[model samples]
Target: MSQKSLLLTAKQGSFAVGTTPIPKPGPGQVLIKIQSAALNPVEWKIQAYGLFIEKFPSVLGSDIAGTIEAVGEGVTGFAKGDRVLNQGTRGDNNEFSGFQQYALANADVTAKIVSSLSFDQASTVPVGLATAAVGLFNQGKSNSAGLYPPWEENGSGRYAGQPIVIFGGASSVGQYVIQVAKLAGFSPIITTASLTNADYLRGLGATHVLDRKLSAEQLKAQVSSITSASIQIVYDAISEADTQVAAYDLVSSGGTLVLVLANSIPESKRTSDRKIVNVFGNVNAPDNRATGASLYKQLTRLLENGSIKPNRVEVLPNGLQGIVDGLKKLQAGVSNIKLVAHPQETA
Candidate 1:
């Protein structure tokens, strides 16, 4: 069988809608007939810099929502026609990527989509939620704060009265971080974003949403006023050099600074008292698989109960082809929205 997919024709090449053979699921996997696939900054970076995906004619996407088209051997909990969402692996083979009409997802990290969410909303969950979950709760990892997961037994509200500052709170990952931090009982959850996003971020569990335009000094002063307790954990979802520096400065001595990108803090400013971890958010990665699977198990309930919410979505038109323009818009910048495409509607 054949299906339409948006292909990165070569490293640093243009994206194009093209036909590819639909893949059958292997053992422990299920084939997904993709309904919606969301774009991430990483996809644009891949095309612009030839990063992660080395293979030419590759498919690039991490978040998808769809229905199970077929189930492979040993996957018992899921069957054909079940609505689900999946986190596709970066640099994984084409059959496991999300840009295609049909892709295979390992059963362990796939979760059913609750009735309340459209495929667009469910499609926004995987990558953003995984990045937040793995970055904050993956124990024994430098990339995480090693905090107890709230979804686990006796883990809820473990950090009551503690404070966390998430840079880029309006970002998709930052939005999930705010929600997850609330579940973990981090008091006075603080985030930085444009003032326009304050109410929305607050609704997502952020207690304070500071303006992104603030200077590092100004932000520090504002954060200091919010909590007297040492600010121990800071998640820099933006992770740009300036944001990293600002975020790193907010971490109290002996605290951990979590970044979604490479550590850009200059050595002269770094101190032994502070630790910086650049998170690799892909759940399919060897280090994060266990946590990813665990999160998937609890995801449906989390969404159903409104404990975690999807980012507001803007669906692009033209199906897979629409993603080409979406990528450009993403590269230019967007706020408080996830851009999604309906791969099955490809022309």
Candidate 2:
């Protein structure tokens, strides 16, 4: 059987709905019937900017939620009909790169989706939550028990009672970081968002919300008053020159900063004790599979057990055609919530 998909042919171009051969799962792989695919800013940016992908007619989504339709030889612990969510492949020809009705995902990258989460909600999670988890626990080493329970003692000694600031609190990534930081026992989780999103961010565990409109000095003062000690960990979900500069001022000596985007760090900004980290959102890279798998499993448990809630998703109609329109909305930035496109029909 063949499968239909929405393929991006070139930079800043419309997605073409086309049919491709149904891919069979290989060793350590599982074939999935995609239920919903979530759109991220990176999706449109990549399509518009045309970086990373080396070829045309590529499937671009990374956050995917679906059900297992087939399992390859040597794959264990998964069966047909199992609902799953995973970070899709970064390569152009990979079967699990998303934006398709059917995908073949690496078994290790797949995690059972929480029963309470809709496919849309599940689809919105893996990229943002996994990125936040890696940035906070793996890179920044923030003492949050939610991510690294075994490292609690180490994190506690380093970060307990210390303040951490997230520069874009209302973003899907920032919201998860706030919740994880709170659960890890970090105190005074501070963030920045527009006035409309201030209360929303506070509801998601933000101790303080700085208005983005505020002058840099005013923002700094607000953050300063939130913690007696200087901000020790900074996660920049929105990495612009101004935000980076403000984050540098917020951090004291020896504090760590993590930036999600791949912007270049200025030489003058380097400090002997301060470290700046960049997250590429590729948690499931071969070398980091263990950590990536563990985090996905933990996030699934957290969502299933209500330890963490799924982010809001704006759902469009189901079908491959709807996906192109949804991507346009994402590019225009008209919607505040994540946009999810369901490619399958449901009763």
Candidate 3:
């Protein structure tokens, strides 16, 4: 069977809408007729910096929401027609990525979405939530905070009264970090974003939303005034050099700072008491598979019980073709929202 896809023609190449054969599900996998595919900064970075993907004519997308069209052997608990959302491999597998109308997903990491969520909303959850969960809760890992997961038994509210700060609260990953940190009982959750996003972020469990425009000194002052407790964990979702510096400075001695991008802290400023962790957010990576599976197992319940919420979504026009422009919008910058496209609507 044939399907429409948005293909990156080469390294540092343009994305074009094209035809591709729909792949059948392999064992332990399912084929999804993708309804919504969300854009991420990494996808644009891949084009701009020629990163991660070495193969040409590659399909790129990491967040997908759709209905199962077929289930492969050995996969139970999921069947055809189930509404599901899963994170596609980050520039690793074309048939498994989200840019196509139909893509294969690992059953272990795919979660059923509740009827309450539209495809566009569900599409935003995988990457953002995985990045948040992995960075904060994946225990004993180099990329994570090594904290106990709140999704486990008696794990909820595990750190009540402890303060956590997240930079870029309005970014997709930042939003999830705020919510997950709340679940872990991090009280007085603080984040940096524009004033316009303060109320929206607060509703997502952030106790304080400082302006992202604030200078490093001003941000530190605002955070210090919010809580007298030492900040042990800081998640820099923006991961920009400046943000990383500010976030690292906020980490009390012996504390850890998580960055979404590569570490850029100068060696002169580094200290033995402070630690920086650069997060590799995709769950499909071999190291993160177990945690990814575990999260997917409880994802439905989490969504149904209102413990996890998706980002606000803006659906772009023109389906697969729409994503080219959507990536541009994401590259230019957006706040407090996820951009998504309906691949099936591609013309």
Candidate 4:
């Protein structure tokens, strides 16, 4: 069978909504009929800057939600027609990427999408949630803070009195960080976002939503008023050089700060007392497979109970073709919502 896919025609070239052959699932993988595909900033960056992608006619999408068409060998507990969501990777071959109507997903890291959530909504979870989960709990000083994961024994509510200062609480990853941090029992979850998003972030478990417009000094002052405890963990979802510096300064000595992007904290300001970790959020990567599988195993329970929530999603029209414009909107900047495209709607 053939499928409609959004293909990057070439490096720094145009995106073409065209046809590609549907792929079969390999061992320990499942073939997915993608219903919804979410657009991320990295997808656009790859085309504009020729970043991670090298092959011609590559597919570049990460978050996907769909139903299983077939299951490969040894993939128990999942079967044909199982509703699922997973993180897809863009490689030289591009068969596993989510921009196409049919893609291959490793069964180990694909989570069942509960009845309460639509495919569009589920499409928002994998990338943002994985980034937040991997950065906060993945074991390893290089990849994360190595904090206890909430899914582990008594890991929930483990940091009762600790304070977490998250820069950019309204971003997709920021929303997940707030929810996961709350599940981990962090006290006084503090974040910076537009004042308009304060209530939304608070509903996600952030205790205080400081203005993103605030200067570092102003933000620090507001955080000070919220709790006298030192800020031991800071997750900078924004991770701009300026924000990273401020977040680094807020982390207590011997504590860790997480950045979603490269470390831009100037060497003049860097210190050894604290650590800064840049997160690679793709769970499908060989290195993160163990953590990814563990997360997928518990994802259904977390979503069913509303302990972890998908970001609010805005679905674009015309399926895969709509993703072109949607990426433009993402690049122009969106606030507090995920933009999703329906792959099956291609025409």
Candidate 5:
């Protein structure tokens, strides 16, 4: 069997839609007939900047939602035609990657798609949700805050009355963090974003949405006014140098500051007591697989009950080829909306 895919023909080269053999699921995996695949900034960065991949003819995509086409050996609890969503892998394993009509997903981290969401909406969940879940709930200081996951026993509302701050509240990952913080019982959930998105962010559980452009001093004063209690958790979804600096400055002693990108905060500004943890957002990674599996188990209920929601999606054109164009738009920058493509729609 063959499938259409968007391929990077060379290092720092143009992407083209080409035919490739459809991948069959290995043991413990399932073949997904992809309905929707999302484009992320990392995808374009990999091609234009030649990062995270050394192999030519790479297939780059991470978020995927579709129906199970075939089940592999020992893969129970899932059957052909089941609606599901998962994170796609790249570089080392092209067969497990998205941006193609069919890809293999380990059943462990794949979640069933509730009737409430379309494939496009479900496609937005894996990467963003994983980033938030691992950073806040993973019990490891190296990459997370080491806090209890709300979906676990006696975990919901555990942080009630405690203040939590997040930068980029309107971003895909930040929105999930706000929702997760609400479940964890964090009170006075504050975030930074454009004033235009304040209401939407508030609807997502953010109590306050300060202007993202606010100077560090102004944001500090605003946060101070929201609560006298020290902020114990800060998730910086943007993680630019300025944002990291401001986020770090806002962290209370011993509080954890979660960044999505590499630490860029200057050494001179660092403090011994405050912690900065950089999250590797891909849940498929070995270190994060268990948490990823746990999150997947609870994901369906979370979406069905409205406890968690998907990012709004903007569908692109030309199926797999549309992904080629969408990556350029992602490189330009996007707001809260995620760009999604229907790989099976390819010509």
Candidate 6:
């Protein structure tokens, strides 16, 4: 068997189609016939910044929906031809990263795809959905004031009702945050986005959509009027310097702010009681396997049951070569969209 994948040849470069021998699954891994793969901002950022990638000619793509072609040793509960979606981080450095015609995925991070959703829809779930899920539930204690609904039943308890705010609610991650916040029973899922996206944000479960372009004082006042409780939990998908400062003001002492981007929080802005969190969505990167696997499993259940929905996907028709164009579109700030490359035309 043979496979073809999109490869980034150098820093700030385009993806070239590269061919490789079909790879066999290793222990606890499965080989997938990749049907669809989603594009993310990190794909272009990494290409431009040369971060995280260890070498050139690297495959890029972290969200995948496919069919398992073969199962490796120690893998059970999944068989050949089983439809699936995987968070493709751990296997990213391996032979498959979802941009290819075929890729390998660890059994632990792969989940059976929901039958009701299309492969394109499933392809959009892994990274953003998993990140939102972990941000809301993994690190912090569940809120009991009925501010947000709980996504799961931990032995400890569920999120009873917490006032949570998702900044950048129009972004893909922010959209997931809103839905998850609503499902988790978070009351008044407040968010900040441009006026154009306000209606969309409300439809996705945001109780209030404040314009992010507003002056800091106006933004703060709007958030303050909605809830006297200092925002207990904030998921800042944008994580800009200005946003971080605003987030600090919105949260009370002892509140938690989860950031999807890296190190946007300034030390001066942090209160002794407030907690700042950085969410690296790649949970399967060796060190985080134990924790990542548990979260991936829960996320799979949520997707299968329709507890959360996949974001809007803009499918590129031209397969591997379209990756370069897709990346350019993302870099230019494409709106209300997540781009997906369809490796299998029939899919």
TM-score against truth, every candidate: 0.99, 0.90, 0.98, 0.98, 0.98, 0.90
TM-score of 1: 0.99
Model 5 residue runs over 4 Å out of place are: none
Residue-level lDDT tens digits of model 1 in 1-347: 89998889998989988899998888999999999999999999899988987777999898999999999989998978999999997674888888879998999999998888999999999999999999999998776878899998888899999999999999999999999999999998999999999999999999999999999999999999999999889999999999999999999999999999998899999999988887888888888998889888998899999999999999999999999999999999999999999998887
lDDT of 4: 0.91
User: RMSDs, each prediction?
Assistant: 0.8, 3.2, 0.9, 0.9, 0.9, 3.5
Model 3: per-residue Cα lDDT over 268-328, one tens digit each = 9899998888788888888789988988899999988888999999999999999899999
As for candidate 4, its clashing pairs are none
Q: Clash number for every model?
A: 0, 2, 0, 0, 1, 15
Model 5 clashing-pair count:
1
Model 4 residue runs over 4 Å out of place are none
What is the lDDT, from 0 to 100, of the residue 281 in candidate 4?
93
Which regions of candidate 2 fall more than 4 Å away from where they truly are? Answer: 139-159, 334-336, 345-347
- Predicted candidate 2 versus true structure: per-residue lDDT over 25-94, tens digit per residue: 9999999999998888887777778777877778878888999999999999899999998888767685
lDDT (0 to 1) per candidate: 0.92, 0.76, 0.92, 0.91, 0.91, 0.77
**Location of the lowest summed lDDT over 10 successive residues in candidate 1:** 89-98
TM-score of 6: 0.90
Instruction: Decide which is better by lDDT, 3 or 4.
Output: 3
lDDT-superior candidate, 2 or 6: 6
- Give residue 296's lDDT in candidate 6 (0 to 100): 66
